[model samples]
Target chain A: DTAVSQTPKYLVTQMGNDKSIKCEQNLGHDTMYWYKQDSKKFLKIMFSYNNKELIINETVPNRFSPKSPDKAHLNLHINSLELGDSAVYFCASSLKTDTQYFGPGTRLTVL
Target chain B: AQSVTQPDIHITVSEGASLELRCNYSYGATPYLFWYVQSPGQGLQLLLKYFSGDTLVQGIKGFEAEFKRSQSSFNLRKPSVHWSDAAEYFCAVVMTTDSWGKLQFGAGTQVVVTP
Candidate 1:
């Protein structure tokens, strides 16, 4: 039983294409987060949701949207994906003031 | 305005040698520190964390970190480096003022272990 899991481990699409990544956590946490790791392996927070309520929204492009259907799931959708959007996206979940658990990343490649 | 710094971009060490990765944070209040490791093409895994109580904290995989409030540093140390220990290490801090616990991560340091 994985604590956190993501779908579509690898994604390859041309520029202007739209894509989505799904994440779910079995840990029953109230807070979830999305992070982007660029080619240089520098990770930055993108969005955070607590109990399906949006919390932290970093200075990310508007094309990237995070939707939380429930406390256990958080999905990211990229509209008109660009070359710069090609990177590894990670989903993490945690209790308030607790250590976060990350899921397997989804690597997006923009051709 | 808060930031985490990992001074070394890359480090090379021989197997069985000791390893130390330095981390420093810039925040006014008492900080919550963490160390995470990411293997090639893998997600990050928590190595250790320093919240309170003890200045020295032990973590999984035979790793330990010492937090020095005066220096604003929480450096990770491993007594013996193994080949599997070669990975990118990141230093992060949770802002005390933030209730959601948003983490500020460093640029990460790549460790190369030689046999």
Candidate 2:
């Protein structure tokens, strides 16, 4: 069984289109996060949720939103997807400790 | 603000040779540090982490990292290299807040192992 899994490993959408990526973790972790890896391979944290509460919201554009319905799932929704948003989106979960388990990233390609 | 720096953008090593990847961080207090590896087309995997206690921590896949408080560095080292070990490695630091775990990552370093 996959500890952390993301659906639609690859997403290709046109500009101005809205898309959502789903992430689920079975490790019973209390915290989940969304990270974006740009073309330069720089990973940046966009959002972090602990037990369905928004904990950290980095300097990300308002177009990117993260929703955690529960402790086990965290989904990312992107509105008005632009060319600059073409990158790999990774979902990760961790307990109170700093060890994070990452899901297989979803490579998003916005045309 | 907490930040991580991986000075070596790329490193190449011969098979069976020793390897080392340097990671430096800037933070007000002692911060939690981590090292992760990402294979081609795969997500990042935690190699090891340093919270407190011993400075040296061992991880899976024959990887180990040493945390140096004096230098504010956490460097990963391996005794020997395998071709399968060629991948992108990242160093990260946790934000110094009481909130849940949130990580700030470095740019990452690409490792190329040659036979």
Tens digits of per-residue lDDT for model 1, B2-105: 78999999999999999999999888897789999999989999999988998999999999999999999999999999999999999999987789989889
Candidate 2 residue lDDT tens string, A1-111:
999999889999999999999999999999898999999999988999988999889999999989999999999999999999999999999986558899999999998
Instruction: Tell me the tens digit of each residue's lDDT in model 1 across A1-111.
Output: 999999989999999999999999999899999999999999998999999999999999899999999999999999998999989999999997689889989999999
Indicate which candidate wins on lDDT.
Answer: 1
Which CAPRI tier for candidate 2? high
Weakest lDDT window of 10 consecutive positions for candidate 2 chain A: A91-100
Measured with C-alpha atoms, the lDDT of residue B91 in candidate 1 is 94
In lDDT terms, how accurate is model 2?
0.93
lDDT of 1 at B46: 98
The best candidate by TM-score is 1
Which regions of candidate 2 are displaced past 4 Å?
B96-98
Error of 1 at B111 (Å): 0.5
List TM-score per model, in order: 0.99, 0.97
lDDT of 1 at B104: 83
